[model samples]
Target: MDPDDGEGLFSDAFPTRELPPASAFPGQDPHALGGARDNILEVAIGREVRSFRNKLGITVADLAAATGLSLGMLSKIENGVTSPSLTTLQTLSRALGVPVTAFFRRFEERREAVFVKAGEGLLIERRGTRAGHQYRLLGHNAGNTGRVVVEPYVITLTEESDVFPLFQHSGLEFIYMLEGEVIYRHADKLYHLTPGDSLFFDADAPHGPDEMRQLPIRFLSIISYAKDEV
Candidate 1:
């Protein structure tokens, strides 16, 4: 199927929202949210890249040559010290002989529904404990049907950094701020969200949260992706 065809699928599956202008967050630079430091998503990508490279008996230099990236840059990416851009991830995907989706966690089985009482969901440590980002998986598909899968999670953020690593995938993402405030960055724009405010957009766009305020800002994130894409 043509790659562009998926855009229609996304539109049909999820309702679109008009995004506010980047100036919505006046005087805020989206680039200021991230730097040489790593976030959970970057760490996960780094680990996956290293694992795939090692499994193929490939060296950093070899990967650098294949991906046309500098050895130093690749090293920083692999060490979770820096995050790669969409173009960089695509290049690495080609070099590793895998789809870009391979960098994300995989969920196989499908389930009709799942329930998690307050404070009872599985606590995931993707960003590491020191990062002060808490992610709890609420539910996901557990069946074998190769249809679109929906996974929901509750995220608690305590990081005070102005910048953060961004991530993208082949899917749609919906975020609803539950408590406190946060600056949600999508591509080149930033949206300030408060309790009850929600944002929905294409997941393939590089996006993340920055400038989290209030000791612990909590939100609900729902990720929808085609099962076959995994």
Candidate 2:
């Protein structure tokens, strides 16, 4: 029971109960991706194997024959139903003409990031939309070959900005008001958003700004959509 241990339940510097878990989030995030960590490595390996096999124009049967593994075993491995041993992975690597490490490439891939300086974001033109709105592309993953694509933008509306209602698109959208008050429409619903306010909605239905309650409005818009099928 040393007070200097800093392991006490109510320690000033390292209180155990006060620290949040690694996966704990600040608040309810509308557009936040779920935190599911189960079988991620297996899934990544399976996808990589399948992708390589397909790229080589080889079927599962062909892969099995090349690796001297059974059809059922290869099927299980490719579907990520079971984890393969190092020997099995080596066999797959040889048969697929890839390195054994390639199977885990996706699972061990480095996390990517993009940083934009203040007032350095790229300006974007909104097609098929009225004028007076300024769209700045804050950040986006460059040439990401992943399953999901995310685009973040900062939208500013001035007195001359046209209120374009009903914008239809695919995927999900999130908005956080930064500078002004506005009424936003999503499908049949309307939300009055002020500074620090937020909204999340499905983009498949029509949605857009309904009214500008305050001038020089600015907001962050984050959109998430699935990548096109290869």
Candidate 3:
């Protein structure tokens, strides 16, 4: 959707996605939104990667040879089943004449901001249209580049999240707990995190929060930096 063409200089910014539920993260279900968010991001990445390659008339084989990666791996990365390592992504980015970060650019045509009151934040909900998990964009498309975007969100936990394998990339995620408690799963370890506790880690490691508290969990998740070229 397009941002409303009203007001001043930044008026033409890209529009954000629809507002998801704002309810505090329920402890039981957090992974509900993982699949959908992952899917959207995956599709976005796939489209960008393919578009860039197609623009160069570069075939899968051509990319494979240029990047010194296996065609099978490249195919899997593009398909979203697996994320590429930084070195591999850098090679591909160089070959494409764009920054590795270019792959993560979110081409949101519309951008707007939604403010949630202290007691009136919208609930993050799971609808049949998408999957489980709900969120609201903290700011207008502030940081949407595939490599780095500063998105603050109130993530709700409604289900037990599965162990997300490590995501091999170059980025740092800083999460500040605003309310309730959660379990941060990294690799084979689990760390219990509560409100006010901040956690920062590499985006390359497959990591996600597990809602174990009965009360809803809310946090500010920040992707401080991404190493993609674009």
Candidate 2, poorest ten consecutive residues by summed lDDT: 1-10
TM-score, model 2 to reference: 0.58
Please list the C-alpha lDDT of all candidates, in the order they appear: 0.74, 0.79, 0.60
99-142 in candidate 3: lDDT tens per residue?
97798875343344567666554444322113334565454333
lDDT of 3 at 181: 72
lDDT of 2 by residue, 1-230 (tens): 33223354334442223446847877766665533432388777888999999999989989988989999988887777888999999989998999988888878876767889998799877742365788899877647767887889999899888888768778899999999888876665566789998887778878888878888899999988887721
- What shift in Å separates residue 17 of candidate 2 from its native position after superposition? 31
Worst 10 residues of 1 by lDDT: 1-10
Q: Which of candidates 2 and 3 is the stronger one according to lDDT?
A: 2
Off by over 4 Å in 3: 1-131, 140-148, 159-170, 227-230
Q: Write the per-residue lDDT of candidate 1 for residues 1-230, one digit (tens) a residue.
A: 22223243345444345767887868746578443233367777887899999999989999989988999999998877787999999999999998998875421212245778888888876532345567799876746465888879898876443345376777998999899887776765567788999988888978887566554788899989888777
lDDT of model 1, residue 196: 97
Deviation in angstroms for 95 in model 2? Answer: 12
